[model samples]
Target: MTPYDAAHSQGSNVLTDGFGRTVTYLRVSVTDRCDLRCVYCMSEHMTFLPKAEVLTLEELDRIASAFVGLGVKKLRITGGEPLVRKNVMGFIEGLSRHLRSGALQELTLTTNGTQLEQFARPLAEAGVRRINVSLDTLKPELFRRLTRGGEIARVLAGIDAAQAAGLKVKINAVALKDDNAAELPELIRWAHGRGLAVTLIETMPMGEIDADRTDQYLSLSALRAELESFWTLRELPLTTGGPARYVEVAETGGQLGFITPLSHNFCEACNRVRLTCTGTLHTCLGREDAADLRAVLRGGGSASDLVDAIRMAVDTKPKGHDFHIERTLPPAVARHMSTTGG
Candidate 1:
């Protein structure tokens, strides 16, 4: 039997998927355009969506308000790089108003750390409580190779600014075999020194970029084994709303997290859906099951109509997804990680 609850229909605005997962977290991609050309995300000289096709801040505010009304407690602003979008601070401040009004419980952001130094204080003032920055390699030369001209110093400066601004910061590292795999211990130590947690994620096969993904498929098991060889890991209580498995590093008295989307499946506990900048509701990351929320928004739909559309999208959520590297590419694998708000 599928793990669906048919009794709760579209009439009510509760966002529960087929697997009995109560969806409360909404990741909103503000823009698909990014400044950096990471090896695993997109190719150099990429084409971005036209400005007219992107949703205005007002439209995003309305859509976000509707989701909050349906019991969404948390909202994460994501992007190719959220800071790269124009007037992003204003957008964040608007979301902050929702938090202030008690309509939202948490407002956070996931950024590439390229532009955090300039926006950290303003962002925190805007009521963003937590921030997640993507940092794969600590070494400058390696960072340049991976991100294609990204400066390590700038990211480090951004992290410093985030910390100084009194915002809770975390580092997200994508584990790549024979690439940054060996640097895990050092990376952990560096992040721990700054009182920040590090979440090492096994790279998922999102899009076909200019990289040998087959060689880059490093398992979380390998990463954990490498860490265990030096430091002791103690299982910690799960408090974060995301899928990462947390462990306390006994050596540094710091926290370490593993998001093993590829090796270990966490779909059974999935409780989130993605809203692209184009206003499409993607029920699953590894599946192409999407509903055009933009169409509903632009078709003279009422607030109730928008809620009904979201309900219908949640109803079509898959029980689980089959995301693994295949000799032949999977249809869903065509999704660019950048565009998907990964």
Candidate 2:
């Protein structure tokens, strides 16, 4: 029997937090390194975790398996850029077993789309049907300015490659007031024209970046009202299991989603947790409390011991996160979104 099956046989496979939220989604950060440093995500001069500090691929798989054993149905591999990690495809292929065995419902990743041109076909072959690509703007200069030095052409080509590979692509754009606010209408129309779903996220106050987050933060509620002027947005009663709420666009017959953590709190139904590259389990993205799964793993703990650690961590999951954006205050959480597997 598989580890998950063995755990299930023991009858201790459910993971429920203190608020009675049954945790079902796990986002794992394979690495803290990235090819491009976005202004909103990282500091101008960022310091990454040491190689020895990050968990190995095998360790990641083992922990993820334990989570699956504990009723985690969806797993999303994230990173500063997950594909940039060496031999990550093999790691993803290894996890495909749970998908085949019906223990896991979905296996996907959120990428910057720079590496999609090369990894798209392999990803589809590994059973990843849908992926979230981060694209804020289509303008070459603005894209370059946002991602520091990333080429917009490469990202577009990567998106094209992903579509050709039969992978359903969803665009995730961070709503920035001074940056992409005016361009959002064009961006949404472009994505809908291509038969792709787009999710607009408010700029979160997560880490200490060169730019002030207060200046960048845009409320999705306000944005939605503005979109209603040009396009007919009908609220859809659908959820993909994350915090985003969906709406259908009448003109394009496509879907548009909003992830508003700042303007509107989404923690009431929070059923997700983040696992950092260093094996830290963050019960909530907006909170600093975490459990050290790496310590449990490296200390020669047994399978049951690891499971117990996860359960103990879930037991302490906060009812909701404390996320606020004010110029006078620091980040809600000192860690960057990249570190916590955005």
Candidate 3:
């Protein structure tokens, strides 16, 4: 078996989980509130979480610093809709200052890109290196039907603005049944022509999104098989055994990636942990989380205490996900992808 040297290791075993998965990536969810009412995340009668229940700016900073101190080298800021949150720029700027020495090598974000045009430039200036835009359809009518905002044009413009501001742009598409699945090649061509990295993600069966129909998720292996017919794929030397099936196209500009949790399970080599908007630290995406950082923060725990908590969380990583065993996750926890910081 191959081993990870943890190029970004801090000489401390605090970051490696029980299975020896050194956790260097941290996904921080800024808010659980999103304006869109997509069928996947929201039901018709869905209600947003209260503002008071969310983490404060100080809390967020403390948690982020704690993770950074514990050897997390990469962080991605996400949200239900981060742009909607007030003082987001200030928040990013604060994170930038704390990570001034560049110990945090990469800090980026994933957004619906609805408000990217307006905020893209400022975000780039505030130390965000990359931007991942979630776009499922090229047709405006279908975009509106699938996404609550119904604004495909704006998202397209946002991509342009982000690229103009010198941020590495990646197009993130969630292939859904009877929708954009058939259009993968077209999207790949478009992204390559525009010098954008393209990532196809499988539908995560969690919470409200899972309550209905999760059986429709297509596996990454199948997606790759379909792509190989059109493009000559050469392997790239990325972290091996990763969830994202990454390959370089012979003629395509940027590489192609697939995030597969169902058809190809990657929990055995999972090397990341997520901190939700509410300050809960989730060890894995497909399992019920047993540890949380919220209690420590609220209980006046020190940064050292936070570090110990993180180490303990890593020590308890599940043996593996139960996709093959047909084990179901807890219903209450699966309701919101935003809650998982995916």
Root-mean-square deviation per candidate:
5.1, 1.6, 5.5
Error of 2 at 182 (Å): 0.3
Worst 10 residues of 1 by lDDT: 1-10
Angstrom error at residue 47, model 3: 2.0
lDDT per residue (tens digit) for residues 254-284 in model 2 = 9999999988999999999999999999999
Local accuracy of candidate 1 as per-residue lDDT tens digits, 1-342 = 111122222355467877688999999999998878888788776778888888887777777777887878899999999899888887788777668778678999999998999999998899887899999989999999888899989889999999999999999999888888889888999899889999998878787677657778888987798788888999999767888999999999899999987788888888888998989888888887789888987898877788888888987898777688755664346778788886
lDDT of 1 at 88: 83
Considering only N, C-alpha and C atoms within 3 Å, which residue pairs clash in candidate 1? 3-18
On lDDT, the stronger of 2 and 3 is 2
Model 2 score (lDDT)? 0.92
- Give me the runs in candidate 2 sitting further than 4 Å from their true place: 1-10
In candidate 1, stretches whose alpha carbon ends up further than 4 angstroms from where it belongs are: 1-13
Worst 10 residues of 3 by lDDT: 1-10
What TM-score would every model get versus the actual structure?
Answer: 0.94, 0.97, 0.89
lDDT of 2 at 234: 94
The model with the greater lDDT, 1 or 3, is: 1
